[model samples]
Target: MKSMTGYGRSSFLCENVEVSVEVSSVNKRNLETVVSLPRDWQALEREILTLTKEVVSRGRINFSVKARVDKAERPEASWDEKRLRDDLEQLRIFAEAEGIPYHPDASLLCRLASGQKFEQSLPDPTKMTEGLKQAAQEALKAMIQTRIEEGKHLEADIKARNAEITCLVNELEVSSEGISALWREKLLERLRQAELELDAEDERVLREVALFAERCDVSEELTRLRSHGELMNQILEEDGPVGRKLEFALQEISRELNTVASKSPSTEVKRLVIEARAECEKIREQALNVE
Candidate 1:
């Protein structure tokens, strides 16, 4: 079992460069990935997504990569004087032809210098690929472990709430017994007060009571509730991506509880059904974070 929320970070050295990766995730209905890499290393975004998919089946995952060379190993940024002069002359000619003012300043030179500075600091993606993969894997491992620990807590809470639902269902079953007969007796009492005598043994009265019982019967819904509960427990114990299955099971459980609430004539039965439904809802909310 695993949760859909977690965070992990790892940093490692690759040749003269230090590569760091951070991965985090939040609950989502389906799998999604957002990758953030240094502009120079953007080509690795697809590879990062593929690696993330291998570990996460569901969630909105965010991956970020940062790399820098050690100060001692960093190259000094220098401009090609001939190239810079050529570029300046070309820009001046274009500006004059377009009748636009052209002013070359220290800032412009610095801007051109900074471009080379940035490139000098960026490590080659091909050389950093192996290190990035290793760092990403380590970070993912940490995140998965965090998810597993949180999942244990979620499982415990879900199971505890499910047990509450089971107890409520049992109460509903016990309280619902003989409800049809009670309704029939009340009907007879009402008829007697109205000067209309209806014997309990009369064929019409018996048929009406039978029809009432059939309408109010919640036995089938109760049976399915128990079945759904068992299935949920099995789902909780199974390996990998149980959130969807758990959500489906909770939907079935909620449906059964609704049926029981609607058909049950006993006030106590309806109350118990409501309480069971509440527990199912709580479990459903918790299941949203499961993976």
Candidate 2:
């Protein structure tokens, strides 16, 4: 088991270059990675996304990579000879046509060329592919461990709540037995008030009572609930991304509880069903963070 919520950060500094990576995420139904790398190094976004996917299965992750290379390691602004030559030639022709002095100094030409600086840096390829990847790996390791620890705590809490719900289910079962007796008495009394004398063991009376009993019987629902509970426990014990499965199980449990509540005639049983629903709801909320 692992949680979808966690944070990890790592930094690698070599010579005059520094690289740092931060990875964090929140619960999500799908894997979504938002990677923010240095603008000059935007080409590395694919690598960053791949790295994040290797560690996370489902979540909206915010991954950011920051790198600082010293001035000595950065590529210097260079002039575009073709463009500069064309501009100079055009200027000379215009000056000649207007009889103006057009002798340009190196400073003016350099200023015009500075606007065309290369949109890239001069960092060592080995350091980026190897060092940065290693740093990202280390950060991901820490994050996975943190998520595991968080999942353990979530499991403990869910187990405690599940136990409470089980106890409530048991109480409801015990309380349900009285509904049948009360139902029979009510039927007999109503018949007496109408001046109809029917034996309790008569074929007509037995068939009618049995029909009512079947409507109010929650035995099957209780059995299914137990089975669903066992399946839920098994899911929490397994590994890998199980949040979607757990969510489906929760919906099934809620449906079963609804059926049980609607069929139960006893007020006490219905009340207990509501309480169980409440406890299970808490577990469902916590499950949103699972992965």
Candidate 3:
């Protein structure tokens, strides 16, 4: 099992450029991804989303990238002194031939040098695909590691709650065993209170008790609850993205518990049913975060 909540980041430096990738995720009913990259790097979005889907099957995942060039190492920042001098010399010759003043002013030198300065062109994003891929992979691996670790804790909690629910169901079954006898006694007392003499062993009294016992029978509901519990255990033992299965099992268990609670007349049985339902709810909450 793996959790749906985690975060990771990695940085890659190469050729005087550094790229960083960060991946984070939160629980969701299905898989979703949001990618953030430089405008020129939009082409890489498909690759990133594909990689994320390879590892994550359920979550709202976010991927973001940041890149920067080392200013001191950039080729564009280098001065081409020879080119500047040649252009200035040609300009001076042109001025003399035209009978204009040949002397170059400080403003002219500054303007010519400025004109010779190289335009800062950013490196092509397509060329950095390998570096970006490496960073994204590392970040994704780290995120999955965290998710696995967190999943251990979640598994422990859910199993503990499941055990508690099972114990409560067992208690409810025990408490309901004598419910028919209790109902028979109550009915006899009611007849006496109304001043109507009815034998405890009367055919009509036995028939009424049998009908009442049939109505309060919770054996089927308890059997279904146990079956759901077994299904939950099977799901937990299996690998990968079992949240949906766990959720379904819990829902069925909840329904069975409700049915048991309604059929039983004993106060103790009702209390046990409530406790079991609470545990099921807690397990359901934990299952929501499982992947």
Candidate 4:
């Protein structure tokens, strides 16, 4: 058992690039991965998605990769000498025409050229790709570890709930005989209150009541429920993804609980059935996070 909600991040440093990868996920019915990479690294997106699918069976997963080149490897800013010279020539001519004073000092020229000066550097695609792949693999491994830890917790909770439900089932069985006796006594009291006397009819009434008791019996449901619980435990203990299988099994358990609830006759039996159903619902909700 493993939870689908988790996040992990990793960073890789190559020759002149630092790459960071982050993976986050949430519960989903099917496997879906969305990757975000630099435009230059778009070709790697499909490969990354395929790798994720091989590792993570099911989830709404988001993978993000960010890369930055080392500052030392980046080009240094330099003055655009031609553009600055042209601008200064035009400025001097305009000053003379307008009869305004113009100081063509080194500081002024540098200030004027600042806007046009810029560094043009492109990151190495090969280095970035290698770093990104390493970061992504590390992040994926961390995410899977987190999910496995959470799965252990969920498995323990579901197991405890299954135990409680089984205990309740046993209690219901123990009280069933008492419930039948009470029903018979109640029926007799009602008949007596109605001033109905049927010496030959009493036997038939008892026989019908016994049959009704059998029809409303929950022994079969309890048996099946226990069996399902065992199977769920077995699946949880296995080595791979079992979310879909566990979910389907939980649905079956819910169906059985509903049947037991509907067939319940005595108030005590109804209450027990409701308790069992509540446990089943909890397990079902937990199953949604399994993987």
- Which prediction has the highest TM-score against the true structure? 1
Q: Where does the lowest 10-residue lDDT sum fall in candidate 2?
A: 115-124
Task: Give the runs in model 3 whose Cα sits over 4 Å from its true position.
Answer: 73-121
Q: Give the Cα-based TM-score of candidate 4 against the true structure.
A: 0.78
lDDT, residue 65, candidate 4: 81
Clashes of 3: 1
Off by over 4 Å in 2: 69-127
159-259 in candidate 2: lDDT tens per residue? 78877877887887898887877888899889999999998887888888888889999988888888878888888888898888878888988998999
lDDT (Cα, tens digit) per residue for candidate 1, span 70-99: 566667868678867887899899999999
Steric collisions counted per model: 0, 0, 1, 0
lDDT of 3 by residue, 11-112 (tens): 988566677899999999999999998756788898898889898999999999977766575564555688778878898889889989877788987776
Candidate 3 overall lDDT versus native: 0.86
Reference-based TM-score of each model: 0.86, 0.81, 0.83, 0.78
Instruction: State the C-alpha lDDT per candidate.
Output: 0.87, 0.82, 0.86, 0.79
lDDT of 1 at 75: 70
Candidate with more favorable, higher TM-score: 1 or 2: 1
Question: Cα RMSD for candidate 2?
Answer: 9.0
Which regions in candidate 4 have their CA more than 4 angstroms from the true location? Answer: 76-127, 200-203
